[model samples]
Target: MPASELSVRPLTVADMTRFIEVDNIAFIEGPYSPDLVAWQRRFLEVERSIGLFDDEEQVGGATIFTMRLSVPDGRLVPLAGVSWVSVLPTHRRRGGLTKLMRHQLHDLHDRQAEPLAGLTASHPGIYGRFGYGRPTQSVTLTVPREHNTLRLPQGVDDVTLRLVSPKAGLEACRETYARRLTSRPGMIDRPDFWFDFETDDLDQLRGGQSKLRLVLAEREGVTVGYAMYRTNELGPAKGEVRVNDVYAVDPAAYAALWRMLLNIDLTIATVVPGLAVDDPLLAMLEASRYGEPALRDGLYVRLVDVDRALAARTYATPIDVVFEVTDEFCPWNAGRWRLVGDEKGATCTRTDSTADISIDVRELASIYLGGVTLRSLAAANQVTEHTIGSVRAASTAFASDVQPWLSTGF
Candidate 1:
């Protein structure tokens, strides 16, 4: 069908039921509750909700969340995140998906949202054409029941883990997560994001079950860490436990929380973490007896606006470098940006001079959170450094020792 034959318009409040229906048909096994649809519509706004309709029938829908990310230098940058992308099976191969995506991208560009756009792709191969690249990795780990013990270092004391109601624990979890997410690149939090981030998605692999428990780790009467998990029977003599989400303010608390989860009695011989990448839990263990860890790509980020995205996160070290970013999907971000940073922080601004390093926007997105390094990109020829010292300096300053982990699935 020609793009002109289908109407792509802003989703209105009246389309809620049809929207949910289309989403349900598209996702099939996923959760698209009325309450969730209502909350998402309100939180994201109708203007951000674009739908493809064939003669008033809603065939597909996509939602975008707008927010700012605080950089290491305390600079807040604008970012656009894509979520809830769905299309009816009958609408497949039609121009509905393309129209919706094109319209949304145009809208974002018009808004001058230069920081970039991010999303978790249902089909990894589909979004690359839109200049989206996998910037972060997620890991799933299964540890044998025996290797679950954790040895803590000194000065980490009084760690207490307790169960809390999901509703009651939402605020504490959100607060702690906000603090942790801002410093990490490629992580963006919406203003009314509390609902999705705090609430469980009952349909996802790790979500949707009522038996899942929320464990809050407290120290000195303050909640510092939390985990969402559930236990199930794996076999006749074995049981399995899975962690949906887990986070802590400090290393000790994080380790203690894991230990508590592992030590759960009557359960199978092992525990699994739903989403983890380069998990510290592995290092904290005494040996490699832990179950095998599997790595998978998580979020794909596209910088709609380069300057705003680069300025949003704080850096560990101070350095100056120029990046020639090629954004094929979003033309606005395709250019050279001079990023200068010091102990005080960093700034990303357009420059006409020669670039010290040249890379595609996808490569930058991959390293935006300091997870991937410039050297790796250079090795892959994803990045080309003009100056010898500049590459090392920029990579050292921008790279993060700790890999970023997204506990919530969009």
Candidate 2:
């Protein structure tokens, strides 16, 4: 509780070693591979990485990654991705975490570069007070190899499957990835380094698992899909095929990629991790124990510039209403605003008219991606409807047909 612990400053690449040490300690996970740390250090934006120091011994730190996030109607909005947030155990409850967040929020509001700020919360409850809401959810499917038999769509026989080195298959894999990027809401843009990180495939980084493998799906000699995976074995009898990601163009290609993994010899189960809530696999298999999936929060979004975040996306229907939004954390957004336009486009501006709905900015974040609806939040009393018929009208306008998903983690 001394004044020395109150010191805060931006972190440079040079400070990343100490930063990661304090960070991994806080997370209780890693002394990550040196290769990974080096790549991560280079990927950092020094000016945006804030650190709380106690006489140069780092006590806490957090940083924002500058990226673009896909929103409704295929619009890409600027995203300030909050990552690596941590406060050392020795410094717990001294307000180090609070200082780190307060500094980051004020910085985001002041800079105005990214209209939205987001994070994958280590603890879901920590960021709501900072005006962040759970806008996206990710699901994982674990199917017993025997139960992996899916009633797949037609055209599986027409697709050609090939196994190649990760390096050899990069071109085809990236092509398939590009096609899926902007199709759904909540996808963050991946830079070159992200690709490197995902496919690094080093033996040292494999831990106890097998080497990373690549499988490409081709049709008429053109690549249509790909999967990056590895198999984990428990002695000679039990094995699990762990798939990192799978992307495909058509139902056939999708089926073929999954079928290949499902049929892996001796594997007890096929583990498909990090997928959209409405992932095709969920619909492919019958309702049974095979598709046992775990659901959890993925991305948390906070609107730094409420107006820009609202105006940049397309709405599903038409609605004109004023929202009385509260954000004591970022006070600039705490005001009544009128939004007009929908489907084709929309605009939101400050207004003096009475509010149609009153909601906290965090709740507003929930519905922003069209993943969660105003009606649902209102049902839980998280969103308050003041005008007659406003809840149904606004919910209809803000919703998207497909669920929002973000596969990449910050």
Candidate 3:
């Protein structure tokens, strides 16, 4: 099939039904239920959605949600949360996805609504070409129930835990999440509809596990943390617990909730997903038990408005350097810019000074959160240094006191 025959455009209200149909076909999900369709419309906007049409029939589509993304130093910025990206099987290899991505990036840049665009990638091979870099890596843990005892904190002993229904505990979970997002880089503030989506569950969606359960951690009757999970019966006397999400405001609260989930009765092992690279649970655990830690890409980010995105976060040290950035997809970012800053503030401006270093915008985004360093990127040939010691100086300035972590999936 020729790419020229397919046309991509923003969706209209009347085009939504077909848009959803093509999305389902592309993703291989069955026709969405009427109730689910209504729920989607409540949060998703038709104008913000785009579809690839083949002779007036929708064949591919994607949408973005307005999100508040936290950066280092507890600052928040608008982020375009890209989601539901798919193209029909017949449209594969026809440049359908490539066209959609090109259009989406241009739209984001033109609107100037967000300084960054981000998504959770279903396939790792895609997105890098568009200058999106994976900045955070997550770990999956399956700890046996026997060794799951958390090394208790003195304050945690005062914290209490209890199981509550999802509906009953929604506010507590949302409140804890609201605070956690500010403290952690790469976390996104959940909107009202997102809260509803996370809490609502159907049996089929549970993978034969028990209904979703909510466990809350509190101190002096004030909620500080919560964990959402489910248990599955694998045998007559043994089973496994799968943790869907967890958040906490205090160290003790976090430890307490993990302790409760780890000790859930009748479960031989507990599966925990999206643990930060430096998550405290790693130190509290007695042993690896039956599970091995595996790294998973957490979030892919693109600096749509590079100038604003660079200035939004605080730097670790004071340094100045001219950066020649190559952005093939977003050419507006392709130029030499001087960035100067420290912990107090930073600024990125167009410059004609002799270039100290050169890198792709993707490399810059990967190191933006301070997770990846210029030295490491240079070692991999992903970054080029034109001046002696510039890599070390730039890396030192960009280093983060706390590693970036993204717990939210989308």
The alpha-carbon RMSD values of the candidates against the true structure, listed in the order shown, are 3.4, 1.7, 1.7
**Model 2 per-residue lDDT tens digits across residues 140-199:** 888887676678798999999999988888877777888888888999887666767677
Best by lDDT: 2
Model 3 lDDT on a 0 to 1 scale:
0.84
lDDT of 3 by residue, 194-311 (tens): 8788778854456578899998888999998998998989997698989998888888888888888888777798998778877888877867545588889988999997888998
Worst 10 residues of 3 by lDDT: 198-207
Off by over 4 Å in 2: 1-5, 32-36
- Candidate 1 per-residue C-alpha lDDT over 148-262 given as tens digits, one digit per residue, 9 for 90 to 100: 6666754456788889877778888787777667544445564665544446544444543336678888988898888877777755656677776777888888887878777
Tell how far residue 79 is off in model 3, in angstroms: 0.6
On lDDT, the stronger of 2 and 3 is 2
Q: Total clashing residue pairs per candidate?
A: 21, 0, 0
Q: Native-vs-model 2 lDDT?
A: 0.85
By TM-score, how accurate is candidate 2? 0.95
Q: Which consecutive 10 residues in model 1 have the weakest lDDT in total? A: 201-210
